[model samples]
Target: MSGGVDSAVAAARAVEAGHEVVGVHLALSRMPGTLRTGSRGCCTIEDSMDARRAAAKLGIPFYVWDFSERFRADVVDDFVAEYAAGRTPNPCMRCNERIKFAALLDKALALGFDAVVTGHYAEVRQGPDGVELHRAAAWAKDQSYVLGVLTAEQLAHSWFPLGATPSKAEVRAEAEARGLSVAAKPDSHDICFIPDGDTRGWLASRVGAEEGAILDRSGERIGTHPGAAAFTVGQRKGLNIGYPSPDGRPRFVLEVRPKTNEVVVGPKEALAISELAGARFSWAGAAPADAASGFDCEVQVRAHADPVPATARLEDGELVIRVEEPIEGVAPGQTAVVYVGTRVVGQCTIDRTVSAVPASR
Candidate 1:
């Protein structure tokens, strides 16, 4: 459990269904006794205690598994490396892919557990081939986008007890009715590790900020930058360029070149990516029969971003996606989750992107 209302209600439902449920809280923090700043970070010392109380009320076994080392190596380190390489990564996706499913699930199965149940707002349905991942009843709270990295095996052994819930408020009410202490606990926000929510400052501590040049689309130096890695695609603020365009239009970060320590800026329209591809990817359930060939699918870059109409295909070793409706502010290392209707097909870590706007302008 996450020491939140959603997971507490999920555990209550599982116990009410007469299943032998065990509440496992993962200790992912490297530092001991890390406390939650309001509802910022999760899986802290305070959260573990809350999880224990919820488990006690539900009459289930509770254990705290220390996966701090693995989490640091996989999620935290990878996040820093990606940003240093001028790529934007979603740490939650990496945690779900590597730590939660791969590490936690493997350990659970070895301990004779049938599956890992969580409070994620998603659904797993039994399809003809196997279990398929789908969005929850409430589209606003659907978390299937983040769970897109689960493979067929992972999907088979996963359960989302809060999938059918009408709303988050109802989950809180259920937790209160069950006398769970976490009924009023707020949800975690931003990156859990960075409790303060200052991403650029956090990265600067590790990446080491250095003065660099900011260039325009035509390779003309327009301004100076503190560090190229600190900026992301489509960023307008904190550039410190102090220069307006000839047309008086605000310039947006079009690219970041860590190799040369250069930040490229252009018009906002240039942020739209025509296509993106990645070599590292996995299917949520069964691979599409037409995956190697070509098939139409909806592509989502960010967790809350709207899905766009697209055509995807596996070419050589990469998953190439061409969106009919262009996606803006896309950066390498971000995941592109593909979907067929409400079912999650797969997701890939974006390795490269092609700007929709032509360079001739």
Candidate 2:
């Protein structure tokens, strides 16, 4: 339940629907000390206790499952590896893909459960063809972007009780009406493993810093940085480069070349990308029939970002997205979610980007 108002109210709704619901809280860290920080993170001991209390209030059985080993191997290790390869990754999506839907759902099914339910703000509906994933009614809280990794089989066995809710405030109100203590619990904002949200600091400790040169588009050594892996595409702050352009224009990170150990910086125009190629593509339901010829859709690169008009196609085992308008800040290893109207079509891990400026690198 994540010990949040959304999940508590979701559990209440499930109970009111007359389904047998059991609350399962994932213990994602082996070290108890890691969870001592409490509700600031999803996997905290305080969260587990709050989930237990909510389960008690709902009169449902509760259990804490230890998935720490698998989580570290899959989510944590993948995050480190992606950064080391000079790509920024969304670990939450990885967790949903590898741990929650794959591992947890498999175990739940083996235990005779029909479906795995969560409080995610996304919808799963039975369409004419099959199951389809859609954005939540609450547009601001829509999480279909992260859930895009789910395959058709996984989507078939998933339920989101809070998907139809109009807003998070309504969920909190429902929790209060249900007499749940976590009605006012703050939402977990930081990455679960990264309690303090210091991603750069945490990454530096794991991936040791290596001094590298920051080169301008013209191959001039404009500055130096601690490591290429520490920066992301389109990043403007913390470059520590004292020099400014002759025209006084600010420079932004255009690329991180891990193999060359170089951080490439340039003017903002260099970040304008028009196309993206991605690997590890997964469809929520059925693969589009015209996938090879390209179909019109909207592409979302980051969670909470606006979806842009685009043409998406699968070619030679890779998904290619061509946006109608050039966008900025697209980075490798990030997910590119595709949608037709409000229905989630599919997603893939961005592998390469084609920018309007040749010097973008």
Strongest candidate by lDDT: 2
lDDT score for residue 284 of model 1? 90
Worst 10 residues of 1 by lDDT: 30-39
lDDT of 1 by residue, 21-139 (tens): 99999989767443344567888777888999999988899999989889989999999999999999999999999988899999999999888888999999999878899999988
Q: Local distance difference test, per candidate?
A: 0.90, 0.91
Give the C-alpha lDDT of model 2. Answer: 0.91
Q: State the number of backbone clashes in model 1.
A: 0
Which pairs clash in model 1? none
